[model samples]
Target: MAMDFSNAALPAHYGLHFTPTFHSKIPPNIDPTSTTLPNPFIVVVTGAGKGLGYHISLAYASAGCSGLAISSRTSSDLDALASEISKIAEKRGTKIEVLKVVADVQSDSDVSNLEKEVRQKWGRVDVMIANAGVISKYVEAPSSSGSNLPRGIVQDADWARVLDINLNGVWRVSKAFVPLLSESKDGPQALISSCSMAAHSTISELTPIAYNVSKVAGMRLMECVANDHGEEGVQAFALHPGAVVTPQTKNHAGGQWSDILADDEGLAGAFCVWLTKEKREWLSGRYVSCNWNVKELEAKKDEIVKGNLLKYRMVV
Candidate 1:
C-alpha cells in the first residue's frame, strides 16, 4: 500500500494501519453525524468488473444495502461479479439487488445509458462511486525505468485519452447521476471517486503524467462539488485506494509499483463503505487515504481544520 505520510503527524498509540481490514464496522458512536447519515441504501460503483470495485460491491452487499449497480467495459466480468454477489447476498441473508451494466467511462452514450438504467431500476441513488480510471500507456517515456518518457515528450493522444477517462469520466458520473443522488433518503447523498497516491506525489522512477495530472484535477473537482452543492444535500470526497494489486497497477506501461503495493483485497473497498456509512462530515471536500486510521483522523479534526490540511490552498 502507499505510505501514510499523514501518520507522521499523529500519535503512535492511534495504531494507524493503511492496510487495516476494509470491512471494519463503524462504531455507533463514531461521530455526531451518524444519526443523520443513513445506511447506504442504493450504491453505484464504476469500474466494478474486477479488482477493488468488485470487492467494494461485496462490502455494501454484506452490509445489506438494498440496491447495487456496477458498471464496466467488460461484459463477462460484470456477469460473473453479479452472480457472485447474488450468492453472497443469499448466504449473508442480505436482500441486495445487483445490476451489471457494460459501460465504458470514456463514452458519453455509455454513461447516459448507465444513469438511465439505474434510475429506471431503483429510482434513487445513495452513493455513486466513481472508481473508473487509467494509467497512460506511453511506451517511449523516460523515468526511473529508462523506458518511460519525460513529461515534455509524452504523446498528445495518450494525454488526451488519459485525462478524458481519469478526470472527465468522473465528472460524467456526477453530472449524470447527481440528480439521482440528490433524491436519496435521509440527510445527504455522496460521491466517492477512486483517486491514487500518485495524485499526491509522483515517483521519479516511473512517473505517469497522464494518470497523475488527471487524478489531481479530479480530486479538486470533488472538492468543488462539495463546496458548491452543500445545501443541495451533496457530499463529495476524493479517495486514494492505496496501492492494491490490480491489472492497472501490476502491468501499467509506466512500470509496476504493485510490489510494495498493498496486497489486501478488501482495504479500498471496505474503506469506501465506511466513509459513506459513518458520520465524517468534517472530512468532506478532502482527499482521504484508505491507509490512514479514520478514527485517528476523526481525533485530529480540530488540527485538520485549523491547519487547512487536506484541501488545496496556496497558504496565503
Candidate 2:
C-alpha cells in the first residue's frame, strides 16, 4: 500500500492542493477521431525479459508494430520473447523487424548502445517504454498468520539498490531514447514511464520506502520531459499500471490480498498502445491511471485542460 492523502504527513506543496470547482464535463477540443496513428510502431521496451515489459511487447506485436526492439539482462528471456513475437507476426500478417538486446539499464554505455541499436536499425524510435525497475528485499517475515502486520524496516543497501534500478535506470533509458523520439516524423511519439500507484499513496508498513520515493521522482521526470520538449512535439506520460502479480510476487509467496482485485498485464499494454495514438498532446507531462475509462477522460477533456487537473503542485 502507498500513501493516504488524508492521514500521512506530506510535502509542503501538497498542503496547498485543492480540487477545482467545475460545473460540468466539457468535451476535449482536440479532434483525435481523424488522426490515424502509424501502424507497426517503432518501439523500444526496456526490461522486456518478462512481466509487464514482455506483455507490452506482445501488445505492440499484435498491433502490427514493425520496428520493435526489446532489452533485458537475460538473453534467454529475450530469445524466448523474440521467438514468440515472430510467431505473432507470422500469424498477424505484419513484418516485425525485431531485435533483442542485452543491456543493463544501470549502465550508461549499455543504455546508449541499446538506443544505438534501435536507431541504426530503424532510424527512429517512436515509442520508448522505460519499464526496468526493482523492488525491495524482504526484511522480515510476519510472525502471526491473522494478526496485524508490522512494517519492515528497510536497510540502506535495499534502499539504494531499489532506487538505482527503478529511478536512475528510468532516467538512463529516457536520456538515451528521447533524441530518437524527437527525430521521428511519421506519427505520434512518446516516452512512457512505468510508474506505480505507490507514488500517490502508500501504507508505510506494507510498501517499500525507496520504491515509493522513486516513483514520485519518476513522475516529476515525465513532467520535465513534457515541459522541456512539448514544442518539439514529443509526448511523455507517467502511467500507473494497476496492481498485478509479477514474478517478484510469485517469488514472495504472496498473501491472500494477492488473490484480490488486480488487472491483467495486457490491460496496461493496451493502454500504452492507445496512448501513443494521435492528438494526445494534451496528455503530455501528466500521470494517468490505466483503469480510468479512456472515453470518460475524453468526455471531460475540456475540463481537464482548463482546470489543469491530475498534477502535483504548490498552489490552488
Over the stretch 59-122, how does candidate 1's per-residue lDDT look in tens digits?
7776667789999999999998889888877876657788889999888999999999999997
Ten consecutive residues with minimal summed lDDT in candidate 1?
Answer: 28-37
Across 17-122, the per-residue lDDT of candidate 2 in tens digits comes to 2222211111132122222337646889998999989988887877777778999999999999999999988986668888989999989999999988898888
Q: How large is the C-alpha RMSD of every model relative to the true structure?
A: 5.5, 6.1
Model 2: residues >4 Å from true position, as ranges? 1-40, 143-157, 252-256, 314-316
Q: Give the C-alpha miss distance for residue 187 in model 1, angstroms.
A: 5.5
C-alpha displacement of 26 in model 1, angstroms? 13
- Give me the displacement of residue 267 in model 2, in angstroms: 0.6
TM-score of 1: 0.82
**What 10-residue stretch in candidate 2 is worst by lDDT?**
22-31
Per-model lDDT: 0.72, 0.73
Q: Please, what's the RMSD in Å of model 2? A: 6.1
